[model samples]
Target: MHESFRLRVVETKMSKMSKEMIHLLGNYGHIGFTFVAAIFIGMGGGIYLDQKVFDGRTAPWFTFIGLAFGIAAGFKSLFDIIKHQNKEFEDKD
Candidate 1:
């Protein structure tokens, strides 16, 4: 009976660890995707505006602005996620 209980406890711990690992990995994946998507979307919009609306008159200016906005957005999202995660950990503790 004692042996069985020990085995069960070990199994439970392993499962919990695996679940935590998966959750952490998912968060990382989400962070990466959010960052890249924001950058691409911003740059793409800028390119479209410069080309379609301004007819290339704006040239690289709009592109640069869009890129800067994208980078800022990405960093913001990253910080927000980190903050949220920290809050969650604190709450758990």
Candidate 2:
């Protein structure tokens, strides 16, 4: 009886922890999507400009610049999210 009770307690704790992890994963997914969207938008804009303004140059300078901008934007967004989460934790404490 005691062993079964202990097993039940452990299972309950595990389930609760798993739920929390799932919640955290959902938050991460949102952040990841934001980062990817920013990158794609930047790249798309660059490609459009390169084709229209640059006359489809082989160099792809605009594309490179756009990629850099996109990465920067993504990092900035990630940092902002982390900072906000940290603040929330601090507030909770």
Q: How much lDDT does each candidate structure score?
A: 0.92, 0.85
Clashes of each: 0, 0
After superposition, the stretches of candidate 1 with alpha carbons farther than 4 Å from their true spots are 1-14
In model 2, which regions exceed 4 Å deviation?
1-23, 57-59
RMSD in angstroms, all models?
A: 3.6, 5.3
Residue-level lDDT of model 2, residues 27-84, one tens digit each, is 6768979999989988887888899877898448888888889889999999988987
Q: What is candidate 1's local distance difference test score? A: 0.92
Record all residue pairs in model 1 with backbone atoms less than 3 Å apart, i.e. clashing.
none
Name the top lDDT candidate.
1
lDDT of 2: 0.85
- TM-score of each prediction: 0.79, 0.66
Model 2: weakest 10-residue lDDT segment is 20-29
